[model samples]
Target chain A: MDKLTTVEGRAYPFGMKNVDTDIVIPAHWLKTISRSGLGQGAFEVLRKQPGNVFDDPAYAGSPILIAGDNFGCGSSREHAAWALADLGIKVVIAPSFSDIFSGNAFKNGILTVVLPQDAVDRLMEVAKTDPIHVDLEAQSVTTPFQDRFHFEIDPFRKQCLLGGLDEIGLTLGEADVIDSYEARQAQERPWIVPSAAPAVA
Target chain B: MVKPRTLYEKIWDAHVVERRPDGTCLIYIDRHLVHEVTSPQAFEGLRLAGRKVRRPDLTLAVPDHNLPTTPRRDAAGNRIPISDPQSAQQLAALERNAPEFGVRLIGDADPEQGIVHVVGPEQGFTLPGTTLVCGDSHTSSHGALGALAFGIGTSEVEHVLATQTLLLKQSKTMAVVVDGELAPGVTPKDVALAICGAIGTAGGTGHVMEYRGSVFRDMSIEGRLTVANMSIEAGARSGLFAPDDKTLAYLKGRPMAPAGADWDAAVAYWKTLVTDDGATFDKTVVIDAADIVPTVTWGTSPEDVVPITGVVPDPGSFEDASKQDAVRKSLDYMGLTAGQRMQDVAIEHIFIGSCTNSRIEDLRAAAALLKGRHVASGIKHAMVVPGSGLVKAQAEAEGLDRIFLDAGFEWREPGCSACLGMNPDKVPAGERCASTSNRNFMGRQGPGARTHLVSPAMAAAAAITGRLTDVRELMTTQKGMVA
Candidate 1:
């Protein structure tokens, strides 16, 4: 995870509602075990259309994306987030997002900003010519023309993003706590824990 | 008495190891289902970080997404190799990773291997009053059996593999109550589609829906599974039905379920997993079962739904300009005209399987409709891919395969064939398909391949007519099922 505090850049004005993961990164690109090189496949289908935003040189390497409601609405594939990150999208502003995609974005160090549709529309318009500013500490998105919109995010997620916390490392440090919990379950909820030994090749 | 808790609260609270002041809870996961597509990266992360799985026995891995639904063996009984180099490497990664991490792998040639969601409950790995997680979105299907299951990404997959616990914020509970009897020919798929239409795609975005009332109570386990499987499509992270006698009956003798005194104790605990009387939900959606018809999605999203007797909706009818734009794009991509009769929408392909509805009950429903009928001459391709090898075997034993084959449908091996089209079963470009899968997302079946979501019986009906027809017209008996 990388620290994300302030992201300022041109945004891809993809205002399509219900933009699912399949559209972000199609199923064929999922064969790769590694996460890199997905930038080439990001929005592959939409890029096929002439004059599409992703293919337009004007918005190339844009670190921000403006989308409509229910963005990333299908599949639990993290490839969507990976592709967005690989495409240099550091922030996504949408009216709403599917839960899985939101979590995936947070994990991949991409910021998902939720604002009202009106706010998103304004940003989408400004994205064509000017860079947008997103301040995580302020929980707000601002445009060059002084348009400011506030957003809400989970405080814990905000902290993790600001600090670039490695969640597994932090959780693993509490091994004793986890062991105690397991011990309690071993006594009270034995059926929940499998009795069979772990399998090996 | 303690404050009355909803079914979700009971299950959620029981799994909480710790709760932070910020409402972040470290919740224990009783089960983790993995597939080749998602687990490879997670396992690679572990290997790089030198982090071993904390509880390997709690995890199960299998190859489904990239594996071909074609035959697994040859006449000499030797396993056939995957021709696609990329897909073979993906499967090989899982084969190496699963056992190396001490996690069970239902390998490519294993008869027990199938889609993660279908394999979980069938093997009794998914249980009531426990928390389950998977990398696949349809893991919500296991929630039909009363498990608290939801999908996670590869990053979270690695987290769970290392700690067997997730740092999650509790989701608000929503009660989806249905009353009245479902009319004949209205299967759980119809009810699910109706629910999606009623509550748009993002209706339950941050909520876990608990299906309730008489309609769900009288429903079979398979039926509940069908509805639960589509919970993600309805924009809910998970959907649940309280464990009842039906749930117990479904799991009583499954291999992974407890036996003897353990089974008795498990059932006793499951009995207590229901919502208590007078419990409250954060949101409530009341549905009339009688109002549901044989429904199908006419456009891309699951929310773009209409009854069988209805016409393709005009995007201009929507008051919201953006919604109208979305609908227009969908109509154009689907090659449909506004006000066109849904029954007249011809289908070139028919797919009757996915994690959503590939169970035995789903197969039976299709077989009942296809017994003496045949796929229409104009229908180019039709396939029935069972959820797993076991499901395929069971269908073969019941002679359902004969019915499908006789009806001009291809009977295929289990795995998520054309549902996601990650394998060789992709629908061709510019073709229309009547699918029993959950999503009708753009390019979900294939790039430029239009997919219309429907029930198994309805899909079979479409195959017979070469168009989207009302399953009721062909139904001589109720073949209601949940998949």
Candidate 2:
């Protein structure tokens, strides 16, 4: 994972509210094992409509998405986050987000910036004609039109995102502590530990 | 004196492996349930990183989302047909990965094969005082038995697979106390939907809800499971009802449960797992169960629900502009008019199965309503899918299958059928379905398919009337016929 500090690019200003995981990537696309190539399936239903912003050449390869309140409000399919990442969306500015989707987005290095609904509305307007900027270090989003909006994220998540530290990296970082705890647990509760062979052939 | 602890805090404190300076905790997981759709990439990530599963015994895998509910066996009891190529490929991937990775895989042919949530409880893999995770959001279903179970994304799934732990921030606890007894015909599903309607979908965000008070205390384990299953629908991390005698009796003598002596010790420990009296929660909501009616979701979100006797609400009735806009959009998508009676809304399909309401008890409830009735003439399709093979066999033994078949409803094999369109059983495009599933999101059943989430009896009533008829009305009519 690459460290994320600032995401500055034209944003697809699709401020559709309650855009669920089903719309992000349909269940049909979930059949494939690979996470790659999801960009093609991202917003499959919406892209079929005439002149949808996702298909417009103006915002092609945008690094940010301006969305309405309660974005990603459906299934816990990480494919929603994967599809957004594959489509080159690095930052999603929304009034609110579903907790599970926000977790998925953070884990995938996508910055889910929580802004006021008014701020998101302004960004949606600016994004139609100009690029927007998001600075994770400063915890702020700014448009080319001099509209600056501040946001707040959990300090721990911000650090993890800036450091490119995933859960695996974090767990492995505390390996010694985990090992000691496990040893104590095994000694205390032998019944919970299965006596299977270490490796199954 | 030490502060009294809520059930959420007690369970959460017990599972903490390590606490970080930033207030996040590394919680050890007791179980991990896996399915075909969301886990393939996580396993692939493991292979790419050259990591082995840290605790394969703690993980259980099954193929449910895409498994066909239609029986594939011939008259001679031999396997004849197969799933679609893509679904079959995903199942094949699970089969190929499970043995090599040392995880237990329950294939479609296995009698234990079912919706992961249903299988976990029935097989006694989900016990009290445990923390469980799965890639699917409905994993909250396990929390009904007093476990701290919730959904995780693929990355967290991989993290759990590699190390039986998750790096998580502690969620605030909310107490949802439903007092008084429910009205006659109002099931736990109605209670859950009524709560969602009261709080809105985002009300429980960033919180784990502990359902308490007299209503939850008196609810059967199956009913508790239904209520807990929809916790995610309210945007809560998970919902739990503390384990009791019913929970223990439900688990006793199951395949994976502890033996005689161990069972007594486990029960002793579980007895101490309740919330201490006077424990303060971050938030508390009290509802009168008598106020709840037979409920149904009328829009895309689960919170867009109303009593079955109510009319579709006008967007103009909402004060907030955004909420008004959302209501209008949802109404447009659902092809409904304001002031239209929900009972008058005709439906083309009826699906009575999901992780939500597909257990043997659910089947019996629906069958009890449909035993001497027939599906309406105008209905195009009606199906009853059991939750698991065990549940299916039990339903067959009780003659529920014959009752459904006699009522013009197709009695199908067990899987997550018509809940999401991952399988062949789906409400066709532009069709309206009265479903017993949790989610009623657009395209959840199929593309352009509109779903009205209902209880099993309500779904059976809809099947018999070709409309969203209130189950209580049907009950009264049946009594009158008997008189």
Candidate closest to the true structure, highest lDDT: 1
What are the clashing pairs of model 2?
none
Query: What's the residue-level lDDT of B429 in candidate 1?
Result: 85
lDDT of each: 0.91, 0.87
| Error of model 1, residue A85, in angstroms | 0.4
Q: What TM value does model 1 have? A: 0.97
Interface RMSD of each: 2.4, 4.0
**Best-matching candidate per TM-score:** 1
Residue-wise C-alpha lDDT for candidate 1, range B1-483, written one tens digit per residue: 888999999999998889999999999989999899998999999999999999988888878998898998899989799998999999999989988999888877777888888888888888998899999888889889999999999999999999999999999999999999998889999999999999988998999999998999999888998999999988999999999999999997777877787888888889899898889999999999989999989998999999999999988899999999989989989999999999999899999999889999999999988887788988999999999888999999999999999989998888899998688899998899999999888788988999999999999999988999999887764333211
- In model 1, the runs with Cα more than 4 Å from the true position are A195-201, B476-483
Count of clashes, each model = 2, 0
